[model samples]
Target: MNTFSIKPTICFDTGSIEYLKNIKNKRVCIVTDPFMIKSGAADKITNIFKANKVEYEIFSEIKPDPTVQTVAAGVNKMRTFKPDVIIALGGGSSIDATKSIILFTVKILNASGDEYKKPLFIAIPTTSGTGSEVTSFSVITMGTTKFPLVDDKIIPDIAIIDADFVKTVPPQITADTAMDVLTHAIEAYVSTNNSDYTDALAEKAIKIVFEYLIKAYENGEDLEAREKLHNASCMAGMAFTNASLGINHSIAHTLGGNFHIPHGRANSILLPYVIKYNANLESGEETEAGKRYAKLSKILGLPCSSISEGVKSIIVAIKILMKTTNIPMNLKEVNIDKNDFLNKLESMVNDALNDKCTATNPIKPSKEELTQLFQEIYGE
Candidate 1:
């Protein structure tokens, strides 16, 4: 039997930030990045706290691909603050770090047998990517590897998508994050665990990304595009959270952690290559993943003569989108040293093979296959 679930209560609209006002008379702890605080985005939520008379503390030290040390520090702060509500108010990094903080804090409290109040968790995504708001997955970097932690306890109680927060995002970040949404939707749709419920959500998210990502990237001020992309991200997140992800994410996580590439960019760079690999049929039989890709291409009104042709069409479309949005088409274009990449290929392959997301991948790649795939992505 397949199980499907939507865990978070989501609010998506033009001024959804106002929902924070409902959080009254509580001690709230907000986890965010320094950029969000400095850029005045955090103020949007803080002002609501002030109006609601909610005492709050801001932990704004979260970095991109937040580390275990950073999460530990945030957990320590959360323990001392004893907040009634914990809000994650930035991009995927901040939301993911906050999730780790809450998870570990609860573990610590439970181990000590101390009475603790479970804080109401809220995720307000400042970017339209990662769907970290609704998902139970958190990607935390430890040393040179990214550990994707998955647990229902880390899922937010509420997800607030306010397009206003994404309005000022730079074009490059907008492109990167939007690609991340596409990756999530595609991976979820083709995942071995996918069900009708997940396929529906994933298809809608994919359609929205294709329809609006370019508009949002071209004109950040387009609130309609921004809102649609924001909703797409959340929809994709919900789909993947239940359906799980695939090897595309697994490979991306490994590359991002080791090479210091942005998570979204890493995913975007590896996407086309992974798609081709997943759709490949040595026995000349259509795989489930290939058929899914064909279906997606048909849904998007792309060319579809056969499964292979449909898959090729989808790949071409993604490449065009990446180029139009200025995303690097290969790892080599991202300035990573070729020698270093080759040196680390074995380790990355191992980590990717063991990734939690790999279990749900439609095609289980051997280490040798993964190595070749990585090299191909590196343009070797």
Candidate 2:
């Protein structure tokens, strides 16, 4: 039997940050990056706590592509602080790191046969990407590998969508994160495990991204565009969390961890190629994934004379969007050394193949095919 679920209580209204004030007589741990604290975004939430007289501590060491070391440290801090509410406030990295911290802390407590009270987990995304706020998956970097930890325990209890926090995001980040939202929706829509529930959410997310991403990217002050994209990001997150993801995320995880590429940018660079690869018709027969792509193309009102043509139109449109946003189309454009990429290509392939996301990929790629795909992405 197939299953679908959405666990988080989403709050997306003006002044949604004020929700934190509800936690009274509790220790709250604010997990975020240094930038959020430095840029005064963290204050937005902290001020609420202060007004409500809620005791709070800030953990601001989370970095981009959060590392195992950082998570372990955060877990230690959480154990010592014994917070009742844990607020993940920032981009995907911070939320992901916070999830790992909570998971590990619980594991440690459970190992000692201690009854651990789970904290109220809240994720407030400052950027409209990753949907990490609502997803049960957390991507953590270990050395040169990204391990995606998936568990229902890691999913947040609450998600706060405040467009005010995203107003200061730079254009490049806006473009990259918007593309990440697109990738999430598209991959979820075409996943082998997709259901009607996920498909509807994914389709709506895709429409929203196409309609509002450019507006948000071109003008960050556009609250209407920001709000729409933020909602789209969370919707895609919910869709993928239920339907799971595909090889696109697996590849992005590997590329980001190994090459120090930003997660969204890595996904953006690989998306078009992945779409084309997944949609390739073998023996002149349409794959289920290809049919899904065709349907999505039709939904978007792209050229759709046939299944193949429809799939090709989606790929073309993605390329045009990437170009318009100034995203790199290949690994070379991002300045990765050709020799280093070649050396690490096999390991990358192996990691991607073993990734949890790969289990739901519509097209199961062979080792040789994966190797070829990497080389092609490298522009060899």
Residue by residue across 1-380, what tens digits does model 2's lDDT show?
A: 99988889999965788777678999999999999989999889888888889899999999998898999999889889989999999999999999999999988987889777889999999999899888999989999999999999999999999888898899999989999999999999999889999999999999998889889878988999999999999999999999999999999999998898888898989998898889886548888888999998999999999999999899898888888899999999999999999899999999999999999999999999899999999876
Q: Candidate 2 local accuracy as lDDT?
A: 0.91
RMSD from true fold, candidate 1:
0.9
lDDT of 1 by residue, 234-288 (tens): 9999999999998999999999888889989999998999899999856599998
The global Cα lDDT (0 to 1) of model 1 is 0.92
**Model 2 TM-score relative to the real fold:** 0.98
Look at candidate 2 and give me any clashing residue pairs. none
lDDT of 1 at 254: 90
In model 1, the runs with Cα more than 4 Å from the true position are none
Give the alpha-carbon lDDT of every model.
Answer: 0.92, 0.91
* lDDT for residue 372 in candidate 2, whole number 0-100: 91
